[model samples]
Target: MLKKNLLAIALLLCISSVFGQEMRNCGTMEVDARLLTEDPGYALNQAQIEEFTQTYKSSETGATRTVITIPVVVHIVYNNASENISDAAVLSQIEILNEDFRKLNSDAGSVPALFSGVAADVEIEFCLASVDPDGNPTTGITRTSTSKTSFSTTDLMKYNTYGHAAWDRDSYLNMWSCDLSSGLLGYAQFPGGPAATDGVVIDYNYFGGPAYAASPFNLGRSATHEVGHWLNLRHIWGDASCGTDYVSDTPTHNTANYGCPNYPHYSTCSGSPVEMTMNYMDYTDDACMYMFSDGQKDRMQALFAPGGSRESLLSSEGCGGGVAPTCDVPGSTSTTGITETEATLNWGSVAGSVGYNVRGRQVGTATWTEGYTTGTSINFTGLIADTDYEWQVQTDCGGGDLSAYISSILFTTSGGAATCTDIQEPNSSTGTAGTISTGVTYNALIANSSDVDFYKFTTTSPNTKIRVTMTSLPADYDMQLLNQKGKKKGTSQNGGTSDESIVWNVNSSGTRYVYVYGYGGAYDVADCYELIVEVSNSSWRTDGSELLVERVLDNAIVNIFPNPASNTMQVNYFSVQETEITLNVYDLLGNQVQTLHSQVVQGENLIKVDVNTMAAGLYIVEISNGKSSYTEKFMVE
Candidate 1:
């Protein structure tokens, strides 16, 4: 029996060696030392580490499972196309991160028998940050569309388009995932280096792909391995010619050998037995690897030392707790005539809240009853009439701390005869031209209100159609929605026909605003217009058909499409005017592509850009109208 067992072990080792030898080139890979030595890279030195260690409480306990939680932010830089992965993909990666660190990888059980016994679960947890550096609520993900690809990972830290947002590095781990050059799976900025770029960058392929196209294994766990390096964990092969991973329990080898390897292996590094192929730090097929040694855990812990970039993250405030200086309150109100069952709630974000603890109490009632509050907002089922209620929210910061709470706010449900008014004047300085009312009141006097083009108010106890009548309009017009930044989000034209009076289906529990932009460049004579929005007991609400039109109107690009135009030609100008414009064409090899039109209108002016006179090869169309110029690529079809 003993002889059989030895033979079986020997056979398994041989198989492991073969498995570990499988090779696949990840493509012209080279680590930029200059870039990697930043905050999340080689930003920290021995002095910094020592200083941080002095402040570490671990010297007090010396426990391996120090129970440290790292906040993370995922930036997605992609073309506006499908490469801009869904929000679910980003969240899924976060879930996988927590699972891997906790030794909860679903494939751990499938790990080879020889390595299963050594699978070490690195005790750690990752979470999407709730508070930004300025302490505002965040989903921890930012998206940007850029014409440039193959962005250097280090440059990502400096450009806002990449992910630079003055974030608190110690409290947040920044990770950028994008389309990198083919073959390169991913690279990370190690901690304790020059103080520049911070975080990891992975080509989108390995980020969420099935795995084979990018290499190793499937299920897109490359982020797991790269993030390990991000936390200061070295590759399982010790990142040296001698593949000794330094961890006492791991075997020795003469360099990292990718692919599955046999157990109890032999190595050329001083005749030491084969190395541990299942280390999380090694570039192995995901299915064949599982484990993070205790030494790696120690290195990661060392990163959070006092002076390290991850130092501030160890604080209570950094962990998402303590008294919130901001409002952090959650409140809901309803529109009249609409059943009080549905209310729209808007509130400030509370710190440490995994979610929220929203509870409410009816008017004239002292006992506060618990209400729904899992996500940012919730829909209530049954509600009373002609009643006022107070609501409050508490932060669910992990750990045992729960004393954090926001003050309550009161809102009454309208029983009948609702009058919704704005606390401030309706803004009219900004909005889509011809889509808003630019009457007298929209002039210079309304300073703070300039950001708000309009305001809306609704009551729920009863539903109603708000008949907005202009009592003092020099001329009548419509309104448009404005985003938080005072940018036009939606627009509606009044057509300059009659003294405009528009009817809006306002929700009983929802209130919003639209700004007015006067057309014809003439300011209304009325000093202050009266908008007596009448509310009727009608169950009419705006179906989801409302469209949010976001147009780029800067005239920045003069795009001419169908260069080798046949019949219909389109010229896209950021700001096309009614004036005539000119277009010139040029050909390849330093020659003129073509000039289809000599004069075209300003806005979306389409000219034949006479491609009929051109050939069936490549060409460029340049459009210029004294004010701006744009070039576009087209071919004769």
Candidate 2:
């Protein structure tokens, strides 16, 4: 049995020689120096931290020392199966860190009598994060597969390009493990650097204990040393001859010592005192390095103190003990009561929902005309004739925890005539104003006493003078022509709709809107009234005293489509007479791509521009009447 055991040990050593690194090399100082040249602010921030460390005093032991538990997020960026380590390996690393920092390791007794009195427990612990930044549950280990074989000290492993992005650095200790460049075991970013690259890194080959790691550098001490640098601990020799490590109790050393050194190893600096080669921050082999001095403990704990650099970490809920987040989407949705101008939507309620947010739009449009409601069903009116529409419902669970919007429900409206019944039934608000072309007569009914109609139109320079005629009357109705802002510019209140009209003049040409409603709840459900909007150069004149009109309109008669060609997104423009207009299409970068000079008839003009040749993005359609320009943007995807 003894001969067999010896052969097994020899076999293990041979395998380790293939993958193990014989010497430890940390790149923390090199990375810091490179960043100091790249960013001046990083240098200034580091200087302030050094200034604080030089002035602010820390104590090793007291009732004031509180054990700090830091939440940790481990990003495993790997190129192959071997580099993608298991969760067990990560848990082992966490266990080793806790044992070493608390001075609870089984090998703590190996410290020499001369240094045992000064050996200290740093009073710091770490935990795999239980909650993610999005308030969702997490396993704390993020695994990402990469195409690159290895990463270097440039921090490519800490970003989403080749690896995983860091969690909120202020709330979690971000650690990345990957295949490092040859001979580079690990590195750490010190405090007071850019948050994007702030973290510690380790090679996957040296990430865990003996069960999964190689020899010489195995046992996870590589992380212990790098983490020390993350918390502001420097090399024992300070990376220079007879240099200071900013700690008071550590004996001054001439240079770094490698492997296991015999005790009473004398330094050539000052009185040539015995060096503490067993310190975790030294270059000694893993089995030879163990304890931290009391001075080092105080410096590590300073990060959690008030006004300290990492003080905000104490309030992080990433480790648990907070209200759990809960929100869910709607269930079992259906549409009913379809009509040319009306419809209804219904859905089942989700648990924990106090209310719901609902919105609807034409199938190709981007904006949703909606609001919040406590009811499970919503009635929609002022819908376009023979058009497809989509709407969504979301559950609101209070405390700002809102669920995802449920899948959209689609429905198409039935086609109908424009007479007798109010085709634009729901244009009750300015936000839902219906489109009306100049000189086109519309016959719509007054459904009830509270029914109102709003109509909008676009006019050109020759058509700046406006004339709206409302001849047939069902009740005493009123009309108000307003600017695009819904401000009333003119009104005509001829008693009993005795052929009411509004004629005025303006210096400019653009879109204008009008509102029509009954006076004091008057209506005739069966009769339809005729209304029309017209403009000319010299027909009607205004005295600047009053206004007149006798018609009504409903919700929007336009659509916005994020597609190559949708309902073609009609652009409305009118002139007092027949004329030619120039239309141009330009990309978002201000480069013109298409132009067309077309003749617009005296009545309604429908122009469709083909965008199948363009790539997916946003574009602007401009219409110029040789006097003024009207522009609207559309998307193709």
Candidate 3:
């Protein structure tokens, strides 16, 4: 080692003259300071990482190292054609990174003999991501046109409102190439920071193409330097005079060197050691700085330790291990153009799809009628009215790669002219829930093909057993039961126009809500379906079954008990859905009597009224919901 240092002194003696040039500067620290000031979470993240790295680097020695490949996505935010660099420029930058990190560059041998002993091959490689976050094939490049002439450390280019939002940071290393504001080569966010702005930003002019690269910074070392910061390597100068760069092997520098200063220019701190100006973390020109020290490599590798923030990157399938990834399945299916005989099925498009396999079958049947279409939609014909059917789609990715089918979507063809008007208005959400009386079979519309109905009904002691049943098929419908606290109690999703029902044996007696809606945007304007919220003191299995309860399916009245009652005589009456009803007693002369009961009901109901203040004569009971009326006779003797 003394001999190598003496050899370094010999190289130092060889260069006597020096010249001044524009010093290369990076904005990484400036951005880090800003984020630390503005975002508290970012500061905490940095603190935690710093603590871990401190302990890890000091305690761990000679640990086995493995080659870790990171997937990269280059985002091009440009204003003019000049800023929109070609694919070759981006690829060249990646090549430079591979060369520098893996010690595969042609200049590896050119490293000074003094520091060559501590130079490290970082065992890290980067590949352009093959699969995007959405599981679609990609070139690992994204180009966006922006109005801004140039971006600065403010990072306006990293957002969609200004330029383009970042891809998921956990999956890929994001690099933005743009015309930077005035004078800046590049900057990078450290390992621990917010995901939105987490990446390296490079000047479009210096983005590593030999044809367009400017002098001194042309060899693409700017990206290598910035990515080093991104991987948690401080500048070799530590941004201080003879400050610690956290790597023990590297020599402390007086300050940032410019124009590739001659070696052996010693800092006045501690050992007055010869500055390692050729290190990539130093401020040397691109062609001059080429090596990472063993300590620096260990520092960067610590970020991928068991509890590291970048650990998730180890599991990313973005490269698919050099194999072509599987095709993405179809998403979010919809049905339209419905009739008694046919309807249209549509879904989102899949990337690189050669065709889509569409399949449909009647509900409760196994046989599916499959068809093919190159477009995103297909027409289903020869259908039956009021029949329940389900369909699914799979993407044909070509090359014998087919994706699995998406979940089946349900629909029912309209046929019967069950024209009914909407009853409950403004009952769209829980906040505007309308009151529903138990045992009343309410008829309401899904109206305008997109209505969601919410209703609240109260239960009583021993009668807390609630069963909500939706009948008279209008479209694909679903029902859900919620407790007073808005927690889901039970849900019934029997797809298609088939009757949907949910039975809940609730123990408590409070207001429970019933949410009814057409599945998959299914609704009708002029058709109304029957919804019955039945409450009974009857027993239920709690394992998904219900016993019987007394409810008048058909409207009826009378069956007056006692024969000759005095006060508060039982006047049994039946009614369904929101309605008004009345009961009256008349003498033998047919004179009018007092009205017994008159109110609106939400579902099937049975009411008792008093006949006490009536004369000993015959009387009549009547019930009506304005749509229909029922009556019977008895004596108030």
Q: Model 1, range 1-637, lDDT digits (tens) per residue?
A: 0010000000001122243553322211133233211112121242244345334434622464467788887777785575577677777777877888888877777655655665656677888777665455678887777665555433443344333332446667777767765345666655654333556776666665352223454555677777886775555554444533324455554555566666655666665665666667766676666667555565667666555556667772433663444333333432223344344445555555666766766533335566545566544435554445555566454464443344445565534222233334433343322232222222211122123235443444335444443333333244565443555545543222122334444344344354654432223221334444455665222222223221122232233443335655555443435655566655433355445444444433334444555555444455555654433335454
Compared with the true structure, all predictions reach lDDT values of: 0.50, 0.72, 0.72
Error of 2 at 388 (Å): 36
Clashing pairs in 3: 439-603, 439-604, 440-603, 440-604, 441-603, 441-604
Displacement of residue 371 (Cα, Å) in model 2 is: 20
Candidate 1 at residue 580, lDDT? 52
State the TM-score for model 3.
0.50
Stretch of 10 with least lDDT, candidate 2: 1-10
Is candidate 1 or 3 superior in TM-score?
3
Model 2 agreement with the true structure over 123-156: per-residue lDDT tens digits:
8898999987756688999999997788877676
Evaluated against the true structure, the overall lDDT of model 1 is 0.50
Which one wins on lDDT?
Answer: 2
Model 3, C-alpha of 348: deviation from truth (Å): 6.3
Which regions of candidate 1 fall more than 4 Å away from where they truly are? 1-32, 35-66, 110-118, 161-166, 194-196, 209-217, 243-246, 262-265, 305-309, 316-637
Candidates ranked by lDDT, best first? 2, 3, 1
